[model samples]
Target: MGTLTSILVLSFLIFFHELGHFLAARFFGVHVEVFSIGFGKKVFSKVVGNTQYCLSLIPLGGYVQMKGQDDMDPTKVSYDQDSYNTKAPWKRIIILFAGPFANFLLAFLLFIAVGSMGVNKYAPIIGKISENSPAFEAGIQENDRIVMINGVLIEAWEDVSTHIQESVGKLELKIERAGSVQTLIITPKINEYQNMFGEIKQKKMIGIAPSGKMIEVSYSADKVIGFAYDQTIKATTLILTSLQKLVEGVVSPKELGGIISIVQVTSEASEAGIVALFALTALISVNLGVLNLLPIPALDGGHIMFNAYELITKKAPSERVLTSMTTAGWLLLLSLMALSIFNDIYRLTNGN
Candidate 1:
């Protein structure tokens, strides 16, 4: 059941992505030949208007087949008035960008829904303080709720960490213990810690941990929109940063996971409840959006890059160059997919 739910969620995301391209193409008077929810041999299909909507065998990804705009064969061209090849370069770029933009828009909407449903956050109550640490030396005790730091009112554990990291010299912390409020002055020291990617990094810290207590935070209507926007931007930035770290070797490729890992995590999220499922779905949607914008052949971003060149130079790329680059892009993508699947299997077998 969980696996089925994962497949359905993935399909919905793919459908939404392709719909963006289909709608944009139609808007610009371009003929769409096929709107498929997956790659390879078609298992189900229907002709709707001029477009053939399909459910293909492979559920990994999907595509929009606009007339004269074939990723599989870049050399294919139709210069008819209604064909994609006849569209202006700028228009073509917009058509190419619409797919990823849809994913981001969907993610933003999902985040807003999650916020309305309530977001769980760790309460700013200290669980433990390291021995001889700044917080401990300042007489901070377990179960003491952090009220404010450096005049900034604390709402959650995340706020506490942010204030500590950004503090200049001494931090003025206001805490509530036993229903009584008290103030303490503490100076954070530079400490080395292992981050999420297992990289050692130095940062300012007061050496305090959250008490594992959670609070559900619901935003007002006006604030929910802002919350959604912030969450969407943060998710996008995090994915981009992770990619940068991967390229820089700060994160190992061995940690990469493929469709199997996505399904597993999503399945678990489904079992955890609606809020968890929504949060994971939003994150994955943003991930899809960011990845589809990579400047590689066989992706929306790569096609946009080609179109932008033509827009600037007043000439399209040569057939030979287009075909070669597209082929290389497909090869690179296939190799990465294979590697990620291998890593996923290895982790499962070794119990990582």
Candidate 2:
């Protein structure tokens, strides 16, 4: 049941994302050749108004195929007129941006609904602290009420996790022990361990687990809006931080995951509470949306970049240049996919 639910949720998200592109293309009078719900071999398909909509065997990701999307012909201007390439640059940009925008809106709506229903927030009480860990070194004791991390006000234990995971190295913690406010300076330590996925370089040893005392507060309109806005901003910041770590070589390439990881995570999350599952889905959806907006070839960002260039220069790039870039982009994408899959397999075989 859990697995099925996860699969369904994932399918819904991907379908909506692709639908955004499809609808935008249709609105702009662009001829969309295909609308696929997944990649690889097609399992089922149907034609509707100059479009072949398909449900592929794999329930991974989906795509929309716009006519003349990748420099199909040089002499065919009429076909180009009805194609994605012939659209005005602003129209193309809007169509390109719609997918991610839809995901963002979805997440915002989810957050709003959850918040309006009065979500639970865990009480700020320490359950345990590792011996000689950062918490211990900083004079943090069990049963302390964690008030803040790095000067940010925290209402729940998740805020602590979010702040710690996002902030590297030393962190300033505020807590209330024995009705007295106390400040502690804690330094995070890196721990390398293999999981069923890869060698996860996670921050550890400052281990103070939060006590399980959940509280539900009445949800107000302000709270809903504020929480949703914060969620989007914080998630974006976290992604930027991870990217910086990746560039600095602190994060390994093997830590990168593909669709398999998403499925596994979604399945696990589905077994958790509704809020937990919703949060997971929203996180992944937002991540996918942001990732696609990156200026990498073979992606929406790449197409948007070309459009931007064309607008600025008042001329489209040559077919040769676009072809070469697309080819190189595919190769890079394939190589990354291979490495991630290899890492996943290796970790699984080693019982990591």
Q: Where is model 2 more than 4 Å wrong at Cα?
A: 71-80, 117-120, 126-154, 157-212, 216-218
- My TM-score estimates for the predictions, one after another, are 0.96, 0.75
**In candidate 1, what are the lDDT values of residues 1-352, reduced to their tens digit?**
8999899889999988888988999999999999899889999999988889899999878988888878889988998999998999999988888988999999999999999999999999999889999888899999999999899888889889888888899999999999999999999999999988888899998889999999988888999999999999999999999999999998899988899999999999999999999999999999998999999999888999999999999999999999999999999999999999999999999998
lDDT of 2 by residue, 203-249 (tens): 65477887788877545886789888777777766776676677788
Whole-model Cα lDDT per candidate? 0.92, 0.79
Could you tell me the lDDT of residue 4 within candidate 1? 92
List pairs with backbone clashes in candidate 1. none
Best by lDDT: 1
By TM-score, the best candidate is: 1
Error of 2 at 74 (Å): 10
- Model 1 C-alpha lDDT versus the unseen true structure: 0.92
